[model samples]
Target: MPNGQGGYQPIFILSEGTRRQRGHEAQESNIQAAKTIGEAVRSTLGPRGMDKMLVDSLGDVIITNDGATIMDEMDIEHPAAKMIAEVAKTQEDEVGDGTTTAVVLAAKLLEEAGELLDQSIHPTVIASGYGMAAAKAQEFLNDMAVSISIDDEEQLKQVAKTAMTGKKVEANVPVLAGLAVKAVKQVAEETEEGYEVDLDNISIEKQVGEGVDNTFMVTGIILDKERVHPGMPKSVENAKIALINAAMEVKETESDSEIRVSSPEELQKFLDQEENEFREMVAKIKEIGANVVICQKGIDDMAQHFLSKEGIFAIRRAKKSDMKKLARATGGKIITDIEDMTIDDLGKAGLVEERKISGENMIFVEECENPKAVSVLVRGGTEHIVEEAKRSFEDAVSVVAKSIESGKIVAGGGATEVELSMKISDYADSIGGKEALAVRAFANAVESIARSLAENAGLDTIDTIVELRAKHEEDGAVYGLDAHDGEVKDMMSEGVVEPLLVKTQAVSSGSEAAVMVLRIDDVIASKGNEVGEGGGPEGMPGGMY
Candidate 1:
């Protein structure tokens, strides 16, 4: 037939029909591809799970059970598999651990759901049942939370140690845990009401050169070395200080605006007035016992020379944060502008020192009473190790903050939620209608979490889920699957619930994002703006901080 565009179109030619069938087959191939990738690392679950050795295309090898790290190292091509990867990112971004668990659970759930679909149990029914189960599971999770006292350091240590298990460096767990606790305590002690410590905030950054000793605080970032100026003094002790947010120079006067000839008479007159003003400023600073100046703005050459001659240790271009730290240390007030400086504004300069030892950098600030002045000095043996350590520290900080703020952790990366979805789907089967899709969607959402965890742990996502489901079906073989010794089976079985906090937000958002990607049946080359037209993916939205 002739189409609207005046091009003759094929009207069901057998040969073309066969070619279309092949295209459909290619699309269907993604299903198996996705499932196969998920099935590759199933057995590595639980505390006793084996480690995965990921050999990249470039031949670099990574050995670990951390979910996000493993998935990040893999070269995944399938859209569905990428969806699985997003889940791990969610878990990592939220709970800092349990990503492996989430991925394994999702893969297993999807496998079982697929089987149920084949058995004539529609996707709708299975999904419904999953929703019911998820609700119940949340209840169980809430019941399982061990109410912890903020002052209970032992319990805090337990929490930190639990997060550290199955990480890249097991030997460093104690060190990381201690650092976590110290950071939490430091932050908590500072707030008026002792704010909850989120473990994610306290990150460890390891830099190598000359290692830093544990006792030092620098209010200023160190350059390769101290500033060099002939008039500038090397050191000043017990020096009075003034901190200004503005440039320490006179503003343009009306006389300066008028252009004049290059006459020595006028030039000397300008110089004399400027010199007097400069001397007066210096005299004022000296009267306050101020031998040092810290400015948030740039220093003028004239003022720099005047301060330098007075043996003032002046530092320019200081950050507001550093200024605050310096003020806290020295019991000084930060003047917003030089014009705002009053006679009483002068104070002793904070003692800020830097020391390098054994390839670590440390900053020292003296006479600071605020708890915020205290910062942990984390040491790492290698560059990679230091980076990882720093990441771990940051995770620890956020977790600590959430724990202190909310007084609980969110069911360990939405594991409870997945378990609940299984139950919810089961219940939904008893009812019927559009709600069935909701049930399926929720189940799919939960399964996504499991798959992400498995991928992160470097296990076959499908196999890991299968193993988890098998363990779940077996009752108590897997630690988290079923409770034992008079305890409730899974957190789901115990009436525990996900915390209504950042953890849940990240998991749900990430899972939704992953599911949106998974739902894609075809791949098309589209413009960037058209990529996420339909509300985009879950975690892929505006939620990423």
Candidate 2:
């Protein structure tokens, strides 16, 4: 090290070639990295947004406009960008929609903060101001939210349709929306805290041969397994189903031991004893009067033969999830032991049939009286189409369930974002000084949602924002971007609605991520793995500035 006193001295703090960024440089670099990640997915923000086709290192391709999918598929290396991506993930996991809004909002907030930094404002002031603005934005959201009830099926369908608006299966949204509402409603449970929906109770299965319009909802569970034996009946009417978690095969001893049988007669006796046990197990199931058997584990060959002989429909290797769904749909108990099974343990369904779908045979337990567990079978023209359609359905189903559970909604199409921005800006004027600037920045950041939506729709963003801000200032906050015609319209009258839970989560998570990124003042990176000619610090591709 060179000393200021014109003397040479050796000193070590950071390891040689280790990178360090501190103070203003560190904050600026992190914000830029986060903004880059935000801009990467901002174009995929609304109903008219374009899709991103991300090709991974393995050449696997994902074409989607979903914010969560885009962020997850990208090979992002910057640590700050990864944090911003996590904000989208959190929003997706919590609300199942508004991922793009969350990301774009966070990015815009940092961009605004950077401007404040240039004007000599401190990062702590910006972070603090954002915290207050976030809390107030939540209040505005609650005030604007339209209360609904679980009985409002039409409103719930609108919520699903709104979520599916920008998806690839737009043509099938009406049909898919209906199925999504039905499935979520079937699985919803009433609790002291309003209604709670476990989306897991609603399953989505996809197959590729049919068109998107061919998708349908099953009242009961649809097991991917076919009948265990070809000799078994193809279908059973008035099914009394026995759900077994244990295998039908003869179970071996928990502790292994070698058996020595020198005589051929002794060997035949041992075989006879094992055969008798298998027969007894099947007989017990028959005694229970179960016409259909669903096993979570494998069934022995002899057991299958016996089941077929008794004219009982049997499906082996059923997934635990499917078995649980069966229990709910059929009102049956899952028997753990052969001796423990009884007639009362059997579940009832109108029919249990093995049907061929897309050239694959699958078991369908249909027409359960008031089934609590249901499934949606998604069909499309090709594998990729089916996958994309299924993804769209997942979003629809999740949002519908969320709406039913919360019983509250809001107008979408950037209406809510514009309203929030206006409200927060008014709030900023109430406060004074530099912190107010930060609060105002948060409000402006939120307005980027409307800007991005208009941009994605091929409209002039500046003109759209100017018109939207004027509309909010004069005519209240009902007006928003109408992507279809590139104009501002009332989202409420247009039936473009979303769950309140989605909007609240998006704003809160986005603000939190922005604040986190702004607070970072230091970054220390370890040495890179490879060394090359003319390489910068520790062989990093582009060394830290």
Winning model by TM-score: 2
TM-score of candidate 2 versus the correct structure, residues matched by position: 0.94
Residue 204 lDDT in model 2?
A: 89
- Candidate 1 stretches with Cα past 4 Å from truth are 1-136, 189-205, 209-243, 248-261, 264-292, 300-302, 319-334, 342-350, 357-363, 409-507, 518-523, 527-545
Per-candidate Cα lDDT values, in order, are 0.52, 0.86
The residue-by-residue lDDT of candidate 1 on 400-513, one tens digit each, is 555666576534433544454565566557667654654565556565655554454455656556656655555432123221122223443343222334334443443343
What is the Cα-based lDDT of residue 37 in candidate 1?
A: 42
Clashing pairs in 2: none
Q: Stretches of candidate 2 above 4 Å error? A: 1-9, 529-545
TM-score, every prediction:
0.64, 0.94
